[model samples]
Target: MRLLSTIMLALFLVFSMSGAVLAQEAQTNTTDPIIVGNQDAESLQVVQSYFETMDSNLLAEDVSYFDEQSIQAIEGRDMLTQSPTFMYGDSFTEQQLTPLRYIVTEDVVVVEYTFVGRNTGSYATLPATNQLVSVPTVGIYHVEDGQITGIREYMDSDDLYTQLGYPAYTGVQPVAPFTLPEPNAVDDIVDNPPAFYGQEVTIEGGFGEMVGPNAFTLWDEDFIDIGQEGLLVLAASDGAFDFTPVEETMLRVTGTVYEYDRASLEGTVGYALDEGTFTDYQNFTVLVASEIANMDNVDTLANVDQQPESFYGQTVTLEGHIGDTVGDSAFVLFRDQLVGVGGRVLVIAPDFDPATVENNQVQVTGVVQPVDAPTIVTETGLTLDENLLSDYQDWTALIANEVMSVE
Candidate 1:
């Protein structure tokens, strides 16, 4: 999902003055290490040792510590050599990596650290940033069989290039489309859907907004922002799938970004509504899934208030107190759902029927709609509340596919 720029920036030194001075926590290489029934801690130790060894200018010695076919995550299934750690080591006269922290989980060791060094050397034809840099970076190490099988480093490449007084690198790396079962992160797909739409993409995230037994919303990591619900995911049949839909459960889905929303809600419902047209409906972005699976990770809930700042079509789950359900099929959560009062969203859940409890804590998982979230009042011939609808015209709400309680 990220790019080689990340690697290039990471290999750039932090700041080197006199000798390659490095600072790190106590390094431990143990035979019988704490496992906690997993390899996380062990993998972390390997990464720590690898970086510590690098500081000692012993980069070649640690090459054996990686898998023979080690992968660089952003290199598109290429060997780690494509990212070229050896070349990086040879480029700088003095390099130092300061381990900021280590987060171990799911067989991955995330090293949050700082890289510092002055470009007193050269790599290939490129010269260094004479100025010492202190770029913060996070390296993700994937461990398998006690070896680091893959590594992905994240950092702001542009910032590093600017600071170094180097021309921005505009060449695109050789990254082919993902093979089947592999995925492009939802972030990439959402950033520019027109370019990625119609292409097969595998997205993994929180599974909430169960539209039906076979339909739901795929909430990306940025669900709390205005740009929630990456897209609507619909299956063939309500009961024809393999994975179960649980609120906040991680879901990995492979699908094509099919139908574009031409109108708010197609058919007579959206046609009859006097409410102004919603532009996102015409964006030509929706998901028709071919395969769905569970992503073995836990996703946190997206805050309700912030769901509008990013991707609006995202599916998301949020928790907050409910104010009213008096508007028939719709209820309010995360904000004032009551007519004339809008906060986060008004939930439209036709199937959800519970005793109205004012200010009762509840969880709503659903797809984000643009300005005009089509409602039944305009669709199924229910009487419309003109004043109430006008009151919260500018706000957005969730078309709840599933609703539950924090209790």
Candidate 2:
């Protein structure tokens, strides 16, 4: 990307005076090449020979063909280490240089050629685009004794870069207009819903079931230990985003948290939360999202199992198929229950109906806690059978806030 600008500037500084002297020297050569703008056979041969070496990728021989002053000029542009095929060879594949025009002016041979190639390599740090390009390039060469004594080349670098998928050049790297602070975890916001109420905050969590045209649930899979179900997201204003949410996709929501209230939400969103659909969400935290994006990384159940102690009080989001059912409100969740592979975790969802998601994929968000049947019964008010209680004793369990069927 920097090649054209660097060479132009360097040549302007180094060859301004040397260029005139080179042309004069070329005019004094034994063949006495033409001083007018007409095609001279010998001058064409010298320039063509140089390009032949380039098209053949003959680096050492091509460098040998250039005189000391021309070599220094090329080195001044930091091109000494490059192949004779030059920047185009490094940034492109299947290169073909077809000389389109040759004009001899005052003993200098001006050659115009079409550089055809596939963009299969990086230009500086820019990535390869795998695109084909055929751009015109111009080069001026001073020949004396059939050797290139001075050289200058020109091409539209911006056009080349943009054709290969780079943004329009502003002579510098582009910067974002604004930056957002790190997002808060949905579990942390849920841990004390009132703390985030009425405040604009960004929260990251799992994408839950869509309850309305523009509203959906966002939950932390690792936050199941609590009694809350999930944070309801009101995304009614913007319509759908440019992506479809899947089971493993984690979403980051930036909005103001509000205490769930139908009348209050209807006033803010300009639409009703619907009577029967959101009845169970009363007293829960609701996020009125202004922006939403996918999170690059999210913690999984296997990540928790690798170091259970580290996530004892942390909220986690995990998606998996429902495993063996322990009771009406509890079931074993496995990353891949069908193959009996991957990590597994115990989930206890109060008011959950196992029949609804018998063999379906589900995402669970909750806090990790040690499996104490007595403590669980005290916290969740679940009447667990003796055999089930004994089976999970001394183990780890996620006290789920939300459990939803997923893809």
Question: What are the Cα lDDT values of the candidates?
Answer: 0.51, 0.63
In angstroms, the error of model 2 at 320 is 63
Kindly report which residue stretches of model 2 are placed more than 4 angstroms away from their true locations once superposed: 1-36, 52-72, 76-87, 171-407
Model 2 whole-model lDDT (C-alpha atoms)? 0.63
Task: Encode model 1's per-residue lDDT on 1-407: one tens digit a residue.
Answer: 12333433343333211122222112333322222213436666666777766432222222322211122112222333445444254555557787765645545565667677776666435675567777777665655555555554566555567667776545433222222334565656666778865677888665657654555666663232222236666564335567656776667788777645434333312223122432333342566677887744221133334446453667877655554564566665542221111235666677665453322446677876643534535433546465656655666666677676543
Q: Estimate the TM-score of every prediction.
A: 0.33, 0.29
Cα error of candidate 2 at position 202, Å:
66
lDDT of 2 at 221: 41
Candidate 1 Cα errors over 4 Å, as ranges: 1-40, 54-87, 128-131, 167-407
